[model samples]
Target chain A: MTTKPWDLKQCIKNYSAKGIHGITIWRNVLEGQNLRDARTMLDDYNMEVVSVARGGFFPSVEEKKRQAAMDDNLWAINQAFLVRAPVLVLVCGADGRQPLEKSREQIKEGIIRILPEAKAAGVKLAIEPLHPMYAGDRSAINTLAQANQMAEEINSDFVGVAVDVYHLWWDNNLQQEILRCGKNGNLLAFHVCDWNVPTKDFLNDRGLMGDGCIDVPQIRGWVEDAGFSGYNEVEIFSHKYWATEQKEYLEKIKNAYLKFT
Target chain B: MTTKPWDLKQCIKNYSAKGIHGITIWRNVLEGQNLRDARTMLDDYNMEVVSVARGGFFPSVEEKKRQAAMDDNLWAINQAFLVRAPVLVLVCGADGRQPLEKSREQIKEGIIRILPEAKAAGVKLAIEPLHPMYAGDRSAINTLAQANQMAEEINSDFVGVAVDVYHLWWDNNLQQEILRCGKNGNLLAFHVCDWNVPTKDFLNDRGLMGDGCIDVPQIRGWVEDAGFSGYNEVEIFSHKYWATEQKEYLEKIKNAYLKFT
Candidate 1:
């Protein structure tokens, strides 16, 4: 999670105490924990578990690794179901060993392979299209239109999209694609963050909403216009913020959310 | 250039000596030199000037800055003409102070404003759509589709698009867009570079062709299939490579170009 100092219980307690009632739980934080207890803790705090952070790294050149990824995803789906998280966000992967087209095909196939279990468990598989900067290895699906195309072809209600403003905001076609996503009832979740003018790190240098140049409020208007009345999950992956006192950072997040988005 | 250590004359001399006759000239390298002398130098080496590296930074919150940008573009067009370069690449800029749409609007307006000068100079203006990572402050046009739309709307024989594999290989729509660009007679230049898997720096960490994950030859094939018969420019911007002895670097470039593209 972006709040690097906090464990799962600390996250629930701190976020809810700060009146941030909805939280997305990264799969990493769920390690060495009982799923039922995690659910109970969420219930105790009266905090909603918005979505499971991730479940897919589905594209790999090795068949054994692909199968292993599938198995891991199944485990993640079980975790999401047990923790009462309605959505499992997937950062669909790419393989440097193969062409991106091959990676994309593998991603689709991987998702299809795991769809039945996700459906059986009642957790929507939300494909979060990553920034194209990550196209080498993080994800082959780098645009909403591509994700939309795949989701449409798959045609499963349990399969949808997670629109993170950090990733999708750069796209000129974002508003139109969001409309399309909503029209098909495929807009499953929304994540909020800013693209810093000088993004120092590709993976973990995301800015709080107003700290960067992204027109967060404008994008929020578009997403809302697309009929997504869901959590604007604060998803800032900032080394700067994470290094700071997280309580102060959490306050900053709240203020940024209120002021900017 | 990516060969940051070399000046324009050295670049022409060394590149041509290495049988890398085609060169794209960045404006900074022309600052103190007489355009006539520069042209004569290029001719002496029997080097082909493919393009002037850039011409546009047309978006700014300040009106004065926008006009200054226009003047700079005019100068760039003149330089392209004097240098006998057929094309001037435009990395149309974004203003951090405004929304991306506004920046995009200004980019189109800027190109339109400069059209007459470019036409009069007999130098085609090629819009080089940057990667989305730069959409915050570098270029609002981050996709071939956006560039195509702008070029089509501007509707000038003097206007076209530059396809850089580094900025665009991630797009699933890239092949389709290349076809469309060719059909519209808008594909003016082709630039090639590999995207390093763990790209350390956003601006200057481009890898040599076969050193990274990009399918350069495949993209080259797509460009050729789309009716583009042009030099595949090696446009790497690696700090790692630039720190090396540039003559040896040129050898590496030649090898990568041959092997990858």
Candidate 2:
């Protein structure tokens, strides 16, 4: 949410100008915008369309709600195809009303249901295990080990895992798990962001690369060593950065990326 | 901090009156109080001293700060002894200025240094692995597995793990780790608090046992099955509850305990 002030067109134009070739478009950014035009805009700005920000809130206590989530996910897969993005990142969701194990099972069920369609649409699904803090309502998958377990179980070419430094940096088993994901050929994306000390807020308040406790360069080295030579997609959700001028924030992001990542 | 409205004497009286026989005292409550009198007061109220709330912030970037922490921990072991408590819950600390790995190493070192004092005082050191959110500054150890690993590596009967539901509720490997700790005779304490759905604040927004997503009775079952027959300690740190009438709040806590725990 760093460039909250900008629309998709402006974000593309400015990001490409600042030498950010990658763009992971959230579903909200695609709202009310024509998909064809959005694809054209990225091409016009010489930007590579990284994975679509999300698709997967697969668990709900209510049967109707779970069905509804499936419908929306199908639509999201189509969105990924329309934007010419190869992957749709999954924030595999949780249901606080039920046990976490139940929600986790539902996440696997949802992914398996979407696999054939995702393969047909020529879009891969990247399961992003969020930080444990988000496990309450955001995602049931809270560790790379858990994600690797699920991906290995599914064993689908269309399925993989996205490694986000902000979420997995604190994990002692991170390097080993990254190597496992890479060895399984399921490491699809790498997202960079920092966990600010005294993280004032749970959802927002993310720090830039070098501003927080995460050793981004060290984690990046691990990922690279594991054969992940993909784009380091910057996924930061910070109210602080969004309130600032987008152009200047982009400059800071570039500097942080170079210095840390 | 549900009983923030009460001092140590008042807390003992109220808790004992409410049939809360077991009490885990935070160091803050004993700040200016005489320790011998604190033990006498507990005796008068028929309160059982479960534990001294905390000691351990072992990691600091500065060497002087680390030395100071060791001194404080030595003092805290004395506090636990004076109060006739059997265990001291440790919130093993992390330094944002250094890598988490460095902080983790420092934590192990800190525990080793305090081992002799804790053993001499007849007090077991309980390593409370905090939630991953607290991994930024509060605790380098953020999982039961990590705590279990540390405890087993220490190979001392005096060093064990404190399982706090609020910190570990979301872990997929929680039950397995708890079993491992119990099997190794490293399970020292069981703390109960819930993770509110949104978890509005990082530090203070803890929920009472039955009020949130945590399945308290189920976890208690796991603990029991693993041969842990310790007091189910009620530790809730909530600004909202603390702001209310604690007498009535204690009633609510008792009710939640009976119904959930």
Candidate 3:
């Protein structure tokens, strides 16, 4: 893998040099950075920011905090606009404080509330359905089908879903969902990661391309067959990977993408 | 937790005391002693062994090993009968040297080949759908629905599935699948374990009931509501759980179950 730190500029430069046309950014990387500077960097590297880290997590106990969450999303949308990112990923937050239907309604309203800003900014919002393990805290949208349902209910081309392998590999309806997304033209972003057996940490145990058990190539084939032409952004959260030199990690990423993905 | 080694007799004795009607035995526990001796122990305790450790894992590069694997399964069925184990849990083997689909078909056939013997022995076969991370090297069956589908194909109450929370907790359609299984009279065994955030080992590293993130009681309710009045067998494969004495571990199991499940 690449031995350098996970600097977006270096990643874009490397991606561009390697003929990769797109990249995805996490929230931490975008925080406090000069948006215009990031924009200039992306233009310089000739790379497209396919998707922003995420928004959502709308369920909160405090009403002010929930509103603040929406405001934070607005800021994220603005950042996406500045960086020319086409999609803003939303993770449906889990707060089972109310009846499930009420919670669902709240989430739908949350997404609807943010859609106009996202649309005005010319940024497509992609809802990312996480694994069920994250259903309590990270996302209530736990399947591509669920995301598609939310998107349809919201009724906007500006809202769709981003499919990541780590989250969707276990679905019996995966291929069917992919076909459905493709047919609807709702597939916005494709992220790649492995599901390590005996996944140690829910938050940081994500395997790199070939290190875990997910059949990435098969999933990629489904997406491709479904007409998804986007970046296969590698997103591993392994401690070992993070501990290593980023440059080395990048090299490994390149090799793993070629060899496994 | 129980203070001594995990003896089969103690497992039976303790199981009866707690009103938990069944036990799933591991191969080590079964193999360590004579089959008749184990049966005698269960008989003495007046406890039912719900399922035997395992069978399946049919795919192999070597033909001899593959056949031997089946032979071992037949032996397991015999043992299951001896111990009054109604079901034999299968960890469907992986691709081995063949293609994934081919291996899957081979495993299906292997199961079919064993079904007659299973039926004759009055032992139902419960196919355990492992988590997708185990799809490559463990079981090809990776979803409750898939297991149900297989059961339908087999067309027998003798063939169903063992629902392990650690494996199926991440599924988005869990509620629907559990209902499907219940409706079809295919819900067989229920195993409980927690999915820790950072699962350290694929084989071990399972959490005690409530320590991990899984909404255990919620899932338990789902199962019970779905008409499964079976064993809430606590199966923790964690190094952390094993480090303590068996007595302490048993106590933890009881507490976790009473509190969470």
**DockQ for the candidates, in order:** 0.79, 0.90, 0.22
Question: If the candidates were sorted by their lDDT against the true structure, best first, what order would they fall in?
Answer: 2, 1, 3
Candidate 3 residue spans exceeding 4 A from truth: A1-4, A60-65, A95-106, A193-217, A238-252, A255-261, B1-5, B13-21, B60-65, B96-100, B170-172, B193-226, B245-252, B255-259
The docking category that best describes candidate 2 is high
lDDT of each: 0.91, 0.92, 0.78
Q: After TM-score superposition, what is the CA distance of residue B124 in candidate 2 from its true location, in Å?
A: 0.9
TM-score of 1: 0.97
Worst 10 residues of 3 chain A by lDDT: A95-104
Instruction: Tell me the alpha-carbon RMSD of every candidate.
Output: 1.4, 1.0, 3.6
Task: Encode model 1's per-residue lDDT on A1-261: one tens digit a residue.
Answer: 879779999998999889989988998888998888988999999999899989889999899999999999999999999988899999999898899889989999999999999999999999999999999999999989989999999999999999998888888888899999998899999888888887889989999888889888887888889898989888888788889998888998899999999
lDDT (Cα, 0-100) at B105 in candidate 2? 94
Q: For all candidates listed, what's the TM-score of chain B alone?
A: 0.98, 0.98, 0.92
After superposing candidate 2 on the true structure, give the runs of residues whose Cα lies further than 4 Å from its correct spot: none
Error of 2 at A43 (Å): 1.6
Looking at model 1, give its docking quality level.
Answer: medium
Colliding residue pairs in candidate 1: none
Decide which is better by TM-score, 2 or 3.
Answer: 2
What tens digits encode model 3's per-residue C-alpha lDDT throughout A2-117?
A: 22256777777777777777777877777677888888888888778878877887776668978988999898898888888888888778664432344456678888998899
